[model samples]
Target: MKQLFILFLFTSLFTSAQTLETIFIDNFEDGNAYNWESEIGWEVINDNGNYVFQGTGHRWAVSPTQRNSNIVITGKFKIITNVFHLNLLENSGRYFFGIHEGGVYFNNDETQIEDVQKEISLNEWHDFEVFTRNDSLAFSIDNENIISYKNNTGTNINAKLAFECLDDAQIQIDDLIIKREQIVYNQDAKWVKTGGPLGGIGYDVRVDPNDANIIYVTDNWAGIHKSYDGGRTWLQKINGIYSRTGSTNDAIPMFCLTIDPNNSNIIWAGTFGMRGVYRSTYKAELWEFRGNGIPNVENLTFRSFTIEPGNSDVVYLGCEWTLFEDEVPEGANGASRGKIYKTIYGGLNWIEVLDADALVRTIIVDPNNTNIVYAATGIFDRDHIAGSGVFKSTDGGENWIQINNGIKNLTVGDIEMHPSNSNILLAATGRLIGFSREPDSENGEILRTENGGETWNEVPVTFPSPDADDWTLFTYLEWDESDSNIVYCGASDRGFYKSTDGGRSFQPTTYNAPFINAGHIISIATHKEKPNWVIANSYGGGVFVSENGTFSWSDASRGYTG
Candidate 1:
């Protein structure tokens, strides 16, 4: 019996060095189809900007060789058929559920699978999960455990996972996840969750400036979480987070987090849209709403923010409109609504200091002179060239001027000021790949500005694996506080990178990043006390830690998922 379990996971290509997590994921955003063996009775079309398959009765879509004995497939599915007959991997036995039939059915043996009387509507969207394991096949709807069928009779090799509909039925599907083996990351790059109550993607992470053990991480759709015992455990520090009805975990999203340098207890979380900034004063134990001058209008998203080093009361926020959607609203204009705001009186009020049409993602204040500030505008794959240049403000941000003179890529991803020399500025710019099949384009660039973004020059950097030729874009640049010359840059899909020079050239770093499967290299952190200790955050793969240096990494994502 145990041999059957072991046989299900290990394919011929399986090796001791690497364990596969997710082999293939078809979110269908390409507007075209690939890898399917047959498209009979089915067509891939752009469903209001989301790619989905619209299939007719008796359609089949085959897959490539998945040699492992077990398989798991999931996606949002809806069928118009009165009786949905599905032949998974083989035609010898039929498995399906019908609105009229009342319960799930397996044709081979009625006792092989259990009956769960679940109602699936024709037009409404429903998620389905199916898996093969332990000489049994299981299927479920909306994550409910519904059916388990004996699986010894089907041919394993050259087998195909298929679907069949009856009576001129039509079905639609999206966000397909298919894998032959369950994901268990290996030793070199394992991810352990930092006990995040919210189990999705993390957009931002920060270690407290005062306490190395205190850390803060933000969920893409919920409140801020804090870990007192370094990241071993996490506490949802959302006493006053602004959110709608669901668990603060399901809110619009906490895009960024910042800890006050002077006061560790004071913190701010940037949220999506008009929810603006949520602040916590008493050790993040309780939260309260605080947005005075920042526009309270709809669609205003706070992307990036910063606070003055000595004066925690002074804050600068880079904000822009939420531009993309599955379907553009009728009569809605795709104009850029990027701007910067400032507040010197804590959160009592805010004042708009600059009005740039680019989507701003970073706001930096020179610690040497608070009067000089810079804002970076641009988003992944978004073309805001007319307004998407780095801008700077002198004399306390009263007014701004476009300072992107020599910089080539206008789609700014990040902007950083030098620690030793405040006049030296570093900028990263790029856009996400428009097509899923094509590699990320070579539009991203790292620029250096000695005159505070007045004139910029390209900084030479090398991308990891697949090497510099494969590097498409660069974002999320970090500096080693203990050694300013040792800098790190995230080469998006290309991989993580390092630079020994100040801002001139870079080579791929020692840390092996897995965001190619997880998310963008969003946030990378170096411990305040330990110059070599590092933590990198992924869009979905959770957190990774480097204990000895950049060369060694382990999965810190254990408790992140529920």
Candidate 2:
């Protein structure tokens, strides 16, 4: 059942970096273990002639083979000291490489700190390597030249290569390999497609601060798309943003897109029931409605809104209705009418400033005090304690303050500043312990304040969190218009994070949580003239672009494909 093609020129089986794209090669003579998680007890032994893996003590072995890579697992083992350790996870922390009775060791995902030991061991069946990409990580035992290390810890690597055995270690693994190194983009590749009225769920992407290829992208079910060519090719404007409100209808769901940092064609559109917001004086090309003129826009659900990085016609609208279970509207528990709206002359006119009870998500003004704003709070479905933290406004939006002192699990999922120290603030929280929506057990944190929110600190997330399953929900946080210590966080589900030390520590980034949803990441943008050209928006994974900032990322939706 084998045909020899002969011209395999292959060779690169681990001289450190010359891979040839082979995702897996488990040579256990096929005796079993095919599904691979070996279930904490590993066996499959044949001993000397090979087909190995005999375990004892705290045993375990896994490899579901997650994605993003430059990978290299290479195997053949017989250990002692730390005996046999091997962990993997890129972009969400923890990427260890081990063998220790007190010698040959490694640690990355930037400082989970096994600290890269070295005692050298090669007493018999040797050979072991562990390679990574984008910020290096190399570890070997009987070949590929022993230890060499480096770690950025996050560029979105994918991991699931376990094999534990903590204490009395005497393992014997054999001939395994997992390779990944193949990326060939560029057939005019800027992700080019702009093709259809495609699938749906692309959250928000605006790009066109005067045309870096004129993009627009917004779709819950395909509401607006207009690419003057950056995303290759597409057009589905939705004639004024679709609706039949009285008959049959389709396109009109769009989540978020605010544009107009001084008129990039003056945009704004956040619809998803109650059409509460829409206006595009030509850039997303033609769409009007404007939130039914906000007479306290009812039953609500406009999701996100913010403008006024110094008056983009002064905007701020974050609406969402219904709070606390039984669909309370029967008395408006904790009342927050219209959730918070204020459109000074751009969406015509409207005002309802602080209806604060949570569900705001992001609204950081203060690029030098446009009245100093900040509105982060969240709680996707009403109960995780209704809605949580962060709401400061030194008078601009009039009045508000719940600063969330020294923050810790307060739902608030996004807020940034430090494009040059706007008093240095960064909040991208996580919480939902009760009535879970799945942060498994409140996993999310990156809170810092240099006196802005008056004091807060948590910033140390290489992301390998799961003492029991903290699901990692840091929605979005950006810093790097050009790099203020390079911070970036986006994980509605688990797939983006990188901090060069401004927020103290962070590393799991390479943005690919199974391409979105498995990694959620609601929204993120960069490129205030190409800050390495980044952009991410995915609740359902559409629209991802990282010219370089996150190292490499693509799929800027190419027209929301069908």
Candidate 1, lDDT over the whole model: 0.65
Q: TM-score for each prediction?
A: 0.60, 0.32
What tens digits encode model 2's per-residue C-alpha lDDT throughout 54-117? 6667777775556556677788777643476777754456666667645655666444454445
User: Number of backbone collisions per candidate, in order?
Assistant: 18, 21
lDDT, model 2 = 0.64
Top-TM-score candidate index: 1
Q: Which ranges in model 1 have alpha carbons more than 4 Å from their true place? A: 1-199, 245-249, 323-336, 381-387, 435-442, 464-471, 510-516
